[model samples]
Target chain A: MQKKSWNWNRFLACSEENMRNLQLQKLLERNSMSRSIEIERERETDGTKGCCKMEKGSSGYISEFLGSIPTFLRRCLFQVLSFGPIPHHIAFILDGNRRYARIHHLEAGMGHRYGFLALLSILKYCYELGVKYVTIYAFSIDNFKRKPDELQYLMDLILEKLEVVLSEENMVKQYGVKIDFLGNLKLFPEPIRKAAEKVMAATAQNNGTVLLVCVAYTSTDDIVHAIQGLYKEKQARIQQTAEGKQMGDDDEPVECSGGSNLEEFSVSSADLERHMYFAGYPDPDILIRSGGETRLSNFILWQSTFCLLNNPKALWPDISLWHLVWAILQYQRVRPFFEKKKRL
Target chain B: MGANRNGDDVTEINRIHLVGFFPNDLFQITSSWRLDIWNLVIRLCWFLLHQVFNTVHIMMGIKRVLESYFVPSGLLDEYKDLQLKKLRYLAVVVDSEEALQTLRIIKLLQWLSAIGVKHVSLYDMQGVLNKNKETILRSLSNSRLWEESHEKATFLNGGKMTLEFLSISDGREGIAKAASYLCSKYMKAKTLSGNQNERVFTESDVDIALKAVGCGGPEPDLLLIYGPARCHLGFPAWRMRYTELVHMGTLKSMKYGAVVKAIHKFLTVRQNYGK
Candidate 1:
């Protein structure tokens, strides 16, 4: 009876201690959240605008000068940020564009329009930071499952953006960004595909930065495409080897086929990777999905095996230089852990 | 607000404050002393922001540990009563270093089972968990908490717990295997009509190939990564297309309430399938 009473008393004390811990945690969270928000507000209010939103209208030389002030300031920030590890390849999963439009009560295709502008700004930021590669998931094959009208609107918008990107006045010319479209181009309309090809050709010489736009693409499709390419290549080689063996004369065994048989065609990861669409390009270092959702949603599964995955609360349209910087910061923080994983 | 130092260009700057700072003016960047000061200030700001982010991360870690202990005695019982229907399959990925502690893994499983998780896939990069599968299964079975389907009389909490042990081989390496497996299988049929087989292979074919190779089982709805870094550690890429991955810290500090909280978060989140 005495032992039971002692156990009861211990349990009571533990419950009280647990209550205090919960309250303390809540208090700590509130304190930190408020402090961070205050700090963030001060930082954001200062120079949110960079060269990406360069007003083309007749705002006169004065507004332009005001904008250049922040631009100059940002360049300074980038200079300092360069002291840390700058990600060689940065990829963006352009999620939440449509949702942003919906929330803002904008037109059906305006979300994508804003998203394109955000991309340009982000690209400028990345280039300024000396990043070599920028990959954007512009369209997915699964996105085709949407309404036909919406898909048509998106294609038209894409064409317009292509023209904007191609013009000598844009960042493409300023940064020497070589544009390459990844994924299944065959699935897209002839005009879109042709325009994409034209853009690629126009900027092929530019070596400053490489911009990879994944349209009508899915990672699974990429893997499958690689598999198909390898399969066909192997079959042709086997056929050539078989013909050679057939031509060979005098007691040479045909079943084994001089050791160059189909059975000998061993497939490995590197061999499969060589056939992938972005085979030559290095894997993305940081994958930033600009939206609330944390899922990859079938974007670059094979490539993003070891990269940092950041899902900021901001939608794709709302993503600013701040978002990009935050993602890079997170990536730098986890670099040691990733390095350890690689060593293992 | 930009300073108008040069009297030659006299109009006040009219910049939009919403999105970005674009230098639309045709004026070239002039070197100035104040510009150097601005440069110094922002670099300082950058360092400060970096330190702030680091502090937030540390605070979150501390808060998580505290909150894990903050689970009330009553909530433990409440978790058992939680009818988790949304989570059809759950996965736990332990960091290779922590995967060695078999007892911790067992406790984690027990906690998960107690919370009414029906199916779970346990994974580690180096296949440490898979190597001890027999011992784990025997111990779990001997616990008498979960019973086989044939014996209805002998069972405690979970109706029947289905466990899957996974490793790196079942992930990235499995895809390589599937490729070769598909190649050899299709190469035989391709001899008849090589021209017709030139088309791109579809996703369905890959799925069929994976099944034929017996690489890995069904995709988990929620994958809990127990590691220092927020990584899947080469969990099967194909299966994790839409899997909600949550890092539950390392296995040494495995908490009952944290798992319960994660399961709760999983239950609360609305899974949108390409909507």
Candidate 2:
């Protein structure tokens, strides 16, 4: 039985209670003195069990009413109170499109289409849940390395999604989401790039939600471009400043002689954020990676510092409102952490 | 010790296990009664540890898979000498009520200080609590860090100021008032206040209110955190613009060994995000 591997008795027998305590003690020894005490205090406090047992008579109505309310509604109430704290900026590694298609025994491009459908719904759900920023890693820097036919098909699918943005049936216009493409756009075929540019231009005015579509994106590549851009901006600024100084005219406003790479002279975390592709936008509050994958396959590198990560054992195409809700629920659980960290 | 020699040649010695354990309805199974809270806590700790171990195992497995699938590549030569050391001054923005965790966080900071980490400014953005200043002072007095800090070493002074004045007013008017007050009343340009949006003072200029007070210098370092999510929020971005943020997961998940390990890795490891 699967339960055999999860056998609690054997696991406990492997190490006696005293032995386990000793092990814990040794581990605690490695920690700082105050930390150890804090940990101990936490352990002691948590070790104590608290039960709020209400009387069965008068409060029965409340419980009954609560039970009568739909589970979804109850969840919505919980969500509103919590505000889904962690993972303010979330990245979606939209994987398993092909597998989902195969599982459903559908056509090759159908899976990608279904994934887009799911993305549309989930995007709305995220905004409703108060998620500020969402980045869907629709394509990878390495994905272009796939077989030629598959690559062409994927590119075609992306173009379709982009085209759909302009379609009257599409939600991009309805939702007013700004679409920004991250990754090496130059690496993509011309048609795909043109389609992407069309969507970006169309949604440039809308500001309700920012959907970062990482088509040919890789974390490392993003950093490289950011640094290169920073350098270029800096050189241009220096040239402008030097020219201005040479002209001996201070009246043209200091802004024209604006300095860049000033961050290099004195860098801070904010400087790095401005240098990033998704500058001005908030970092991901929650990172949702489906397909049962718990690892960040190089999503946002510098930006995801205090992000709440939600890994639902669902496929990319299988991601529904429930999965998004579950992720938000998870974020709500650790809301205090975000609240505390925000003070910094 | 086999190091993770990927991308930037950073060693894989430091293992990060970001596991979150939340208490819900089922949590009552082990901890419904008040007395059983201790027992439930121990079980939860064990559960958390189990999850952490699972995460580590998964990370190792993924590492192995990547190793087999990919070829070993050299570090990006252009970014080889990327100093990144200039970025410093960490402003930790947090909510007001959860600022109570500041006591626990103080222990973390002390551990941070012991490890040669300098200059952290704490700002409470959300004014959730309204406790008496005397009680707050007494609470801080009980803390070892507060006791250890020199006259110049101030950590817990900025919370109240940030929450009341700076956070909402957007660091301009409040900072100016505070700066002037500090210069006139305290006679120090950098007088530290406790529990406010603009907490630590480095100068009379209100602009520096948004700038990080310390944690910047010749030495390249890190800004370790214990928080809920990843975004720095409104943490006076001016100071932390380039800081290498290492989220220690949540406060409950924070471990001393983890901090040491992360710092050890940050210092020893080389970073190359781009190839």
Q: How would you encode candidate 1's per-residue C-alpha lDDT over A273-332 as one tens digit per residue?
A: 999998999988898888877677788788876888888889997899988888888877
Error of 2 at B137 (Å): 36
Tens-place lDDT per residue, model 2, B18-108, is: 0001233333344325324533343344345335545764696466444323321222233223232332333344444445675665565
Whole-structure CA lDDT of model 1: 0.72
For the second chain of model 2, what is the TM-score against the true structure's chain B? 0.38
| Tens digit per residue, CA lDDT, model 2, A77-146 | 3233232132456678776677777876666666676676577657655654445578898887767667
lDDT at B190 for candidate 1? 64
User: What lDDT does candidate 2 reach at residue A158?
Assistant: 77
Pairs that collide, model 1: A49-B20, A49-B21, A50-B20, A50-B21, A50-B22, A51-B21, A51-B22, A62-B13, A63-B13, A63-B14
DockQ of 1: 0.23
Q: Which regions of candidate 2 deviate over 4 angstroms?
A: A1-89, A105-109, A169-171, A249-267, B1-275
Among incorrect, acceptable, medium and high, the docking class of model 1 is incorrect
